[model samples]
Target: MLRTPAAVRDAGRHTAHNYHPLPVVISSAEGAWVTDVDGRRYLDCLAGYSALNFGHRHPTLIATAHAQLDRLTLTSRAFVHDQFADFCRELAALCGKELVLPMNTGAEAVETGIKVARKWGYQVKGVPAGQATIVVADGNFHGRTTTIVSFSTDADARADFGPYTPGFRVVPYGDLAALAEAVDEHTVAVLLEPVQGEQGVVVPPEGYLPGVRQLCDERNVLFIADEIQSGLGRTGATFACEQDGVVPDVYLLGKALGGGIVPVSAVAADAAVLGVLKPGQHGSTFGGNPLACAVATEVVRLLASGEFQRRSTELGERLHSGLRALIGKGLVAVRGRGLWAGLDIDPALMSGREACERLMERGVLAKDTHGSTIRLAPPLVVTPEEIDHAVAQLAAVLAG
Candidate 1:
């Protein structure tokens, strides 16, 4: 008879019930695969929600982490660390921005962007104090902090996390007219995800980003693009906004920035918009620490080479083509671009959670977002054959 694994039982006993994880206990991971405690291997289709874009323990990132650990790790924001200047400078160049504010997580970066936008509104845009407003979309997922979740459309993330933060407006995800109607003179910023990851990899309309940029420019509002999950090389471009020829006033970046080694997020913007932040107004203890900087600087250098972006573009086509063919079989629809995809399973067959569980049993690890939608985002290092393998497994799971 089969027995439950001790690792799984222990994990459930010890940890908080915040995450309903799969029954497998991952002991280690490399490239696009993770091994359970019993030595079973599974293709990692989630890629840590696009965090491990370079794959787990990438050599360059690990080497940088090791070297930096020996020399120094933390200096907080109180004193300048050796890695501070290079990370800030390179990340700024990557965003085509004049300045960078480092933070530890995606939530912190989102909060930082909000604070900066409000300050910029009051100082530069000549808006009334405490009256600044920001416009957001319906299906956005910025982060889980109290302030960030206050604007979340997801009931689970937002409910009971209030009295919610005010001064933000929610409009439809891909409607330009609704957004235009929502924006007014008091609007300080228009915050959006170029491709909504948690909302089932939902892609906005083709011209939506450019339209937002035009509207923000016309209204003197900062266009803040939350690129934490959709940025880096996951979307086949350095930033998803590049696909639409739109340049946001502020770029909130995280995920792959730390090369899956450390938690590092940053808000990048021109001096005019970001200059509103004075010292002690915002900070993080481990935001741009030596280890994070060293790892992230290499991530920036890797992105600068353009190889990973090209891989995502070419390999993503192979992935999407395979998935699109399966739509009528068990998948109702497929959304997303580059290496990212959301497969909406036929409700008659299974829920997204059930599909993910089946895939887990068959050695593939994808995650369900909501209802019948499952998201597939393998590491950028995934090969064409591996992509084929993952898709084949999904086909078999559906067939059963």
Candidate 2:
């Protein structure tokens, strides 16, 4: 019989120690719950770090994946598959962009955006050849890709990953003055996350996103919004930037784009920016594969229906209210929008890791970032009762 300890031990025996996962050995999952190897169940509050925004094994996405699997899966960009056009067209429409460049991961999408921005900078914005620069914000977590990390302020993700990629500038997040100072004639793009998900669901001050948008427009620089962890109905909108009433030049999207069934990512931009790339400029093998497109197409359709976004908005209020009540009890602060949140636990009480362990003991699963900050991003499909239960569990943990 499989047990948590033996399963976890054997699983980690050979794997690299890059991740320090919880000891719970999950064997199966459905919707907002997962069953461990020891027959224990836990509420998945983290939701695959927003990758499972639609919940685990959503019926529509699963059916699409299964159907595509039986019919067809892969075809390199050398030839087009039937599923490609619809996926690209719909996603582009959703993003309000003229074209979509499909990729398989968020990092790949970010890299593609960087390349496109630079190409547009040279060919369109007239930035001299090797001098094009992109400005990023501090406390950003676009991805761990070498170039992405080159401008990252996180030590753990950035340290020793050098000689780092250059031509990137970093500025403090939410400070328009610093960003303006960073931007120059050679600036190709200003890349940012509408909400800093890894930095504890940190929403910028009001007007920050719009300010960035205006800055990019006036300076003739592309605005790339990395929505990998915060888009696709997780933030009570198709995109978190929508809440701020801002639209970036390029949208880097992934995570829920696959509906938690597969890896699918994309960059959506208007023709003038994305069209800078010719045929041979960028391509991915499994990107836009029939299977990915089929599943992601359904994902796009689901988002189009607006059901998940509504759920996130309505349920997010309840979630934030509950967490806010716990501020004096144990939480120091709560910050986020929609169903996504970052809770800063009182360090005097316990570290975020300890709080998470305690929450796990009570049948809730969550993830902690930084030191005392725990982020909550439950699946959008989660019910009101589940939200109350998770909040009550957190309250009980904090009370103790």
Candidate 3:
């Protein structure tokens, strides 16, 4: 019988079997590498689903967290803390928005956007309560919350979790015509990921986002962008929406907002839209806690500093070009923006999971989505030499 590590066995026995994570038991991580309990190391190509855009355990974020911890931790929404205003201000400036509402997770940020849109529809757009409809694209992965799962196109996510929240309409992704047909007077917002991260890093057509923005403007509906998985310099820009020069009415932020050290997320918008929520309307106990606020503040600064964004852009081009050279050989195609690339493999030859497993054996770590597509989103801090090494490992894996 194969013996498993005590840590791994203990987790399996005690924890809910919600996730089917890779078998490697991580013991520690720093920068772009993670070491397993058995002392093996691998380049982290997933970056915690882009949550580690700053790389793991970044010194600046750690220092900030340490100082803040000594000062204070949680004060709840019952009272304000010093880090709260700074976090909001910095995040708003980073998003180019007028106001921000802090939350603790990507799902909460998304949920907040939904509530704000509905409230705006009732109070400002004159839609009746429980009648405001929000349009969402198919193949989107917002989060695991019940209300979020209600609109998911993925069967596994929606399978047994329901009584399902209502008031959402589904439209075909990348089809502007479908979206145009779906929207009407009662439509409050269009919530979508700029690039569908979970659906194999699926990128929409060039004009899709700009077109959606225009359509929302024409219909007087709010354009809500769920950038939790794609924003904060993940796609070589501060926000993925910047690629099209479209400023969404509301931006849902999470993941990398915590710099991979804490749970930090927020929703940013102009006051008119987010302002619809009165004091007692919505909040989270840990939202904008001092520790989260400090870490997120550092994250926003690093993202806006343009260092990591440039690295992601430069290395992204290198990685994509290298991977594209394998087309018609092993990879079917490579598609994505910046450091986030999706490798579509020949299904008959090997599944994406197989490719990732092979890569793992060769000292690289990545994840597969859908079945044939593997996503590669290494930390923005990854070096050119590291990129070459990772690509070489992947090339060898495919060649074998």
TM-score for every candidate vs. truth?
0.98, 0.99, 0.98
Regions of model 2 farther than 4 Å from truth: none
Weakest 10 consecutive residues of candidate 2 by summed lDDT: 1-10
lDDT to native, each model:
0.93, 0.92, 0.91
Q: After superposition, how far is residue 242 of candidate 2 from its true place, in Å?
A: 0.7
lDDT of 1 by residue, 12-44 (tens): 897899898888888889888898777889999
Candidates' RMSD to native: 1.1, 0.9, 1.4
Which pairs of residues clash in candidate 3, taking residues 3 or more apart in a chain or in different chains? none
Stretch of 10 with least lDDT, candidate 3: 1-10
**Looking at candidate 3, what is the lDDT of residue 312?**
83
Q: Which digits, one per residue and each the tens of the lDDT, describe model 3 over residues 1-400?
A: 3223676777789889998777788889999999987788999999999999999899999999989889999999899888889889989998888999999999999989999999999999999778899999999999999999999999999999989999999999999999999999899999999999999888889899999999999999999999998899889998899998899999999999999989999999998998888888899999988899999998988877799888889999999989998898789988899999988988988988888889988889999988888999999989998999998998898888
- Judged by TM-score relative to the true structure, which candidate is superior, 1 or 3? 1
Error of 2 at 301 (Å): 0.4
**Order the candidates by TM-score, highest first — what do you get?**
2, 1, 3
Q: Provide the lDDT at 348 for model 2.
A: 91
lDDT of 3: 0.91
